[model samples]
Target: MIESPGILYSIGAFLLVIGPLVFVHEMGHYLVARWFGTKVEKFSIGFGREIAGWTDKRGTRWKIGWMPLGGYVQFAGDLNAASQPDPNAGDASAEERAALFQFKPVGQRFLIILAGPMINFLFAIILFMGIFATYGQAQNAPVVSAIMEGSVADQAGFELGDEISAVDGRAIDRFDELADIVRLRPGQQMQFDILRDGRELSITAVTADVTVEDRFGNEARIGRLGVQSAVLEMETLGALQLPGAALTQTLSSLEMITVGLGQIISGRRSIEELGGPLRIAQFSGQTASLGLYAFLFFMAAISINLGFINLLPIPMLDGGHLVFYAAEAIRRRPIKPEAQEWAFRMGLAVLLSFMLMVTVIDLGSFGLWERLSGLIS
Candidate 1:
């Protein structure tokens, strides 16, 4: 095992991953707003005092801020960097109003707000597709390498070297597909079609519920078939197939995350699995040590996460803006500024509280306090 780097190393790694992501996400909004002819005043990376900047030919002040946590784009009619509409935006000249964000059509505004998350998803898909195109897809077939003694597979007569062809009449070509099918169906009976000794046979067995700790160290009960994969192999995909494969993998990963979250909400999974920036930073360094390909894969996964999180309907987020736009569309007018202010304040509180909770968990996971106490002793 590699020795753990100090806290400074983790902080630096965290910045490297988040900096580009924040830039890309904010740029998505900036570019789309420009396309819609809205006047962008300032495009700043980070939230505090300007560290360095240059005004573009288009009259946009692009700058880096002292704080590197998050960023914003200030539009002509914005009340602040948060993109709230200016109170006097409606009273501007026709030409000025035409170039203002708030004066733009609702459809234009919606597209501009939606572009951020969409770009994140698109960026991940393109990255994955490129990676796959360069290096072949690592394939692991649904072939069993072992059956635990006295377990469901052993009781059902499953043997080593048996290849699973289908489950409950559904064809599965990949090991992950088979595993996923079983993992979500604990206590349920399944009909399996397998090829053993060059002969196809059918077997039925009830899945076994196994309590296991997830990657984040949260315990959850999932189904286990008492089977393991033989080995991992790589399958090359043609140029034409790369996009399709990349998209399929992206959707599958997203679906798994959605289901996992649903389980947590439904009391099937533990909420302790919810991690903060520290967990991400720790994993980032670990993954970087693996190889460039592994690191890129981590980036893609994080990109998808960023996209999904921003699309959630919480105040002070991109999704929150979309929600406001939807309300405006339905009511045939913008929401009152007083109400929007309160909502943003509440959203900020919720996000801060969540960050604090996860940070505490991260410290515990890292054994920070334990190590400190040992030093004191």
Candidate 2:
């Protein structure tokens, strides 16, 4: 079992992992806005009161805020960090109009908002590229070495030394790929293509729904086939192959994330499984203690998640702004300021409520509720 390194260590590790990522995300917006000749009023790395700050030569206030949850880049014509367009944006002087974000073309505005999430995906790819280039990629052949008695695989007629060629017509080259497909598909019937004694055969099975606990005592419900593969192989990647490998890995990670989110939305996964900032800190601390490679891998995974979450089409998010721009492009007119304001308010409410729910879940996962009940009793 893995033990947490205490609260202080977790907080420090969370900041170290999240700070650079937040900077990278905001930088994408800052650079893209500058490229479009828009004036950035502030580039803060966190929210709430500023802990420290300085003005750049270009008149941008670069500051670090007390709250390290997230950051924002506020443009000159923005009402706030959420980038709600100012109602009086058109009242700017002739010179100021050129530097205001609200005055930019709809296409430019879409791209500026898109850049933040896109850069995050790009950053994850770069990190994966470095990792693959340095340590190579490990692959476990999808050949079964053992099967549990009366398990799903055994009940499905799986035999020792049987090679899994495909699942549900999707080709599988690695054991982990098969595991991923199964994990996300609890209680679903799946067709497995098998190569046994040089003959191709098909078998079907209903995956077993199993609840497993991580070393840190977090429990997750997933599909299990009750098969094992011990034959491991490492493929050395060269400079020419790094990009392709990295892109493939990134896409695979994205697929897993999307599937997990789909499960949660479909009620196949519990909402209590959702984690917030506190859980992130716990993971950051745990991964940091594992080693540099472990920490970097966790960072890359979180970066992709951050990018994906921001692209969700909810108001007050980058995707929401892109949606507005799309409407403006089609209608040849901007969305009404009043309508956008109401949408932002609704979005803020939804976002905060979601945060609170996840925070409560995090506290419960830490046994806070159990301890409180004990005290009261």
lDDT of each: 0.84, 0.91
TM-score of 2: 0.96
lDDT for each residue of candidate 1 in 223-246, tens digit (9 for 90 to 100): 899998866676778889988888
Write the residue-wise lDDT of candidate 2 on 198-265 in tens digits: 99999999999999998877688899998998866767788898888788778888998998888899
10 residues in a row with least lDDT, candidate 1: 213-222
Alpha-carbon RMSD of each model: 3.6, 1.4
- Model 2 residue pairs with clashes: none
Q: Provide the TM-score for each candidate, comma-separated.
A: 0.86, 0.96
Question: Deviation in angstroms for 105 in model 2?
Answer: 0.7
Best by lDDT: 2
> Against the true structure, whose TM-score is highest?
2
